[model samples]
Target: MTDATAGGPREVPPEQLHLLTEFVGRSRWFGGKGRPFQVVGVRRLGRLPACADDGPEVAIDLATVGFEDAQEGSGESGQDYYQLPLAFYTEPQDRLEHAFVGHFEDSDFGVRYVYDALHDRLAMGCWLRSFVDQPEGPLRFHRIPGHELDLDTHSTLFSGEQSNSSVAFGEDSLLKVFRRITPGANPDVSIHEVLTRAGSDHVAALFGWVDTPALRQEGQTEDQVLTLAMLQQFLRTASDGWDLALASIRNLYAEADLHADEVGGDFAGEAARLGEALASVHRTLAEEFPTEDRTADQLAELAEGMRRRLDAAVEVVEGLAPHADRVRGVFDALAGLDGVQVQQVHGDLHLGQTLRTVRGWKIVDFEGEPAKPLAERLLPDSPWRDVAGMLRSFDYAPHVVERSWGDDEGAQQRAYRATEWATRNKRAFLDAYVGRELTPAEQTLLDAYVADKAVYETVYETRNRPTWVGIPLEAVARIGES
Candidate 1:
């Protein structure tokens, strides 16, 4: 165990370090699952202030994992930090058996049982109260001056998330605790802050955030900040956009004779609304943040990067080899464009990132792509990239549903209907977003972006879900043929 400061915060015992490593390995939010790593150090950042006497003591610990083999020139030290908020009790609680992390003997408190604090309502309540109170400590909680928090609500941890753990407090607020720790300002927090302050209705309003001084380590710079979590308004009556799309696909499939628009669950209307919401958010981001133009030469560099990625992808996804020439042609056309306008965009946008509520469509998770570095995720990109992601997601919706029905009868008919559904929704979304027919230049950019996204999906599906690899391959074939 290691100390974060020279004299502040206590260190975990050396014997207990393995418990943390095992715990992290079991967690869904831990990103370095497949990689070989060791929990080299643990440092207590601070304790959550203000808890009832009956409640367990809640403390935040930072665990540093060191990787044996580093990716050369990847700008990574091959090490990572994870935020662990633990609730310690004098005795093991039967109710928290599922959330238990092992027991350890403390210097001052003696033997204490630890559990993941986010799962403990009482511990989470302390967190919500601390955000409202903004007490003095190394863990600083900042709040925006709008909504009053309800202290009596219980926190329920969301199970759907992969990279971060989100706990919803009643139906009022949601706290997103980032598991993988990066030392700089998080784009998710910064982007939400801007949109929330601007009164943009497309995003959940940001209430506040949790942060502290960066955990200083060997070969790392000091004086930087680390954002641990963010508090935001919870959409109590919202439906996931991805779920809605799948339902629409299922609805279309049930009535084989009905056209996509004639079906009860036709999603073109909702798709149009989501497109408009994204456009509004993009406009807001472009106005609030900086905007720049990529010259023809820079666009050539972008096209070249796509080609390089395609080259690498071919090695992993052998099916991509046949479509390589056509995909390359699409990317090469991008370099012929005079210039393209760029702005701060949702680095990764898709049906899964959206929610439909009573008010309208709300986009969430502005943290960009999980695979990229924080700096790369924060870079300004053409809004077409987001548009392309959504378009590919539209393509994915019905195909994903169809893939679920393997080797079934009437497969050919379902394939035709699926194409019809995808085409209708994609057209509706694109038309609503641009408000007109796409010009030649615009078409070129959108086509290239869509092709690039499809290439990425091919690589992902090849590694994770081989059966679904055909979805992206089909899209690539269509793009190549066009």
Candidate 2:
């Protein structure tokens, strides 16, 4: 490894290497944790020529391994360094292009840079120039008549979203440069392309994508292979799913004293509309893609996974031992339930995955949870999985807010009010979903799915956020009580 601090590159000292390793591990963006990592190799990709007020840009390739020696107390083996990429940009003067504003952060070693190739003029120019020499895929941008393409001057980056970086120019143009490039066409890009082309109003509009024939090779390859970016119509005033749900809950609690029928800001209406939108999205997906029958083996696998998760939860909530039999009964009932319809559904759907604008609720981020493998996330599953996810969101909102307030009585009251609102809206959503009709079997399947989802939540909360475990633990108890 080499240190690029003080605007020059030098072989990273042992102490600095350790510090860099620790720094990467501590980053919220760094995925791996609780594991041993050794920086096996490093290669500097050369510095970018200084342009205007901007300092030189340094690109480096880091090769790392976990437990290469097969030693005990080492982390998982075969972990690839290809998963992690870092870029550093330095400037003699702090003044940067408006495109780079707010994107770069001050670090111990100059300004630690973020890759927003789409919006950063310099990065965008470099990316475009790299692609301009040899166009990849079907789409290609030609220099306009009598206009010379100045790759260095024409690039700019987009704002927001730490997950992915993007760049754009004017209303009709944009490119979302994905940071974590997994193999195969990303579902977010793939699904949105289909929905947008199909004229599905429920999804964001997708223009096109750029990809290379093969994955970019570290150090050796100048051309980045695979889908580098996606172009789409950006939502200007979009409100995310979390904010929308919070607004609805706030209104519902404000009107808790009023009759449920008379309450203003009742989420029932919005919930029903969202349900209808989801149904339409499902219908479109079913039409565009083929559905598969949920075989016994598949159900068994799902049940087994659920069992493992529940067992973990049970370990945490040992205090609920008296109710273990009832909880097991619910699981047994779910395991035995039939009429499982399998289709392409959103693997992870939560309030945070949606957006509300002047128009209506727009579903986004079909990439699913980052932790899961892409193949598993893209697989067809029960539509009720998504339904269950939303229901879980409804349950999560109040509990999260309650914890935010230190579990005060006022907060608890607010939580109760929010729960009531969520329940009422959930019923309304079901009514809209069922369209005034549901076979007894379908209703049973739905209920089972909901229980299964609650069980999943119990495990997730127990592990990731133990303080909030009570919310799902209560849900597990309520399943039997109801």
Candidate 3:
């Protein structure tokens, strides 16, 4: 029995509601914007210890927000829940002035000033203690066996990413706090655990995770457990694969006479190694998780889903309308296929999601495409989906540098060189990944997946970066021609 009460109690004091709404709108993690809204309710699921009486008290809350007429853009809304980990203090700390949420009146606790706890050292110490001490209750922290967590390590939050807030514990560990949480087994933690325990060198080891089985008054209840956060070993020395690739391309562009392969910073070898690393991850995931063979009928249903998305996308992005029919033809090809193996995969794979370490290439962020439902993300999909994503990323690298050029006379030459670089790396990556050659059927499947990814990118760029929509539109045209 789940207790989902309508108009839940005022978790925060009523007089200070404006401060919260303002803070949430200003935040990058806040999903709702450009729509009339209100924070209807707040469900405080769990709270860490105060750590100090003279300092702030930390609380983990889910704010059930209502977005008026939001379904068109957001897919689902009107009662969405967002995770907000806050610190309530009597006096504001000068160190945390940038992270201040707002000032508030609390009937139970007096006038309270608030800040995002990820930035507060004392508040972060409480978080570290929660995982270190492994507190026992509805809220629990669990770690894998044989790995020791350094309790004395200090906390520093990574301010770069937009999706989740991450705090690094002195280069030893990193804990990712999920902001827009969905209830279920978070694949980010679950997949890392599988690979980590198996001693897979391609992924960072999962240290621990925090979860609570408290309530579902926020919204959906497909699952009872809410994954609060995940802890994993920090890859402090690892360089981002995207950055490394971009640097290689830049090095090529800088040289007057050198071709892509001739450049000292050529990246085809690294790309092939990355491909091998991903293939190994896929093999390990297949061994550890359940896999199934899909029939032609199942492929039809999947194609239908992709079609519906394209149809919906056309309405949002007018540029997609021209290529809609051609895109559908590629998806229709999927309907004629059969006996495709489906297994748990890294739902989203791109150069940005990968790291190049001293040891080898490492894959990170197993959480699939965030827009998809949890059930869909957890489902077994063709490993080609991951391959398609990486392939798309390889295409993106050189174009980014090419776009940076002014009215230089060699724009065309640079574009040609970029194409050469992308093509060579794509070949290296594909050869290493397939370990042989892609059959005609496999190539068709790969093509459809690649086209589908390009379509999604078109919609994304249209909505977020209108100027860049032409990039994907060109890709769509090229894929259609192929």
For each of the candidates, the C-alpha root-mean-square deviation to the true structure, in angstroms, is 2.3, 7.1, 3.2
Q: Write the per-residue lDDT of candidate 3 for residues 167-221, one digit (tens) a residue.
A: 9999888989898877777889888999998899999899899887765544765
Which segments of model 2 are wrong by more than 4 Å?
1-27, 33-119, 125-162, 166-175, 213-227, 254-256, 259-263, 320-323, 337-339, 407-412, 480-482
Q: Quick one: best TM-score, which candidate?
A: 1
**Residues 155-268, candidate 2, lDDT per residue (tens digit)?**
455445446655654443455655545545677777777777678888767755654334344475454333436656666667877776776666655664763446665567
Ranking by lDDT: 1, 3, 2
Looking at model 2, the pairs that clash are: 118-167, 119-156, 119-157, 119-167, 120-157, 121-155
Better of 1 and 2 by lDDT: 1
Error of 1 at 55 (Å): 0.9
Off by over 4 Å in 1: 1-11, 69-77, 107-109
Query: Local distance difference test, per candidate?
Result: 0.88, 0.58, 0.83
| Model 2 whole-model lDDT (C-alpha atoms) | 0.58
Error of 3 at 274 (Å): 0.8
How do the candidates rank by TM-score, highest first?
A: 1, 3, 2
Question: Candidate 1 or 3, higher TM-score?
Answer: 1
- What TM-score should be assigned to candidate 2? 0.74
10 residues in a row with least lDDT, candidate 3? 1-10
lDDT of 1 by residue, 295-371 (tens): 99999999999999999999999778888998899899998887688988998899999999999999999999877
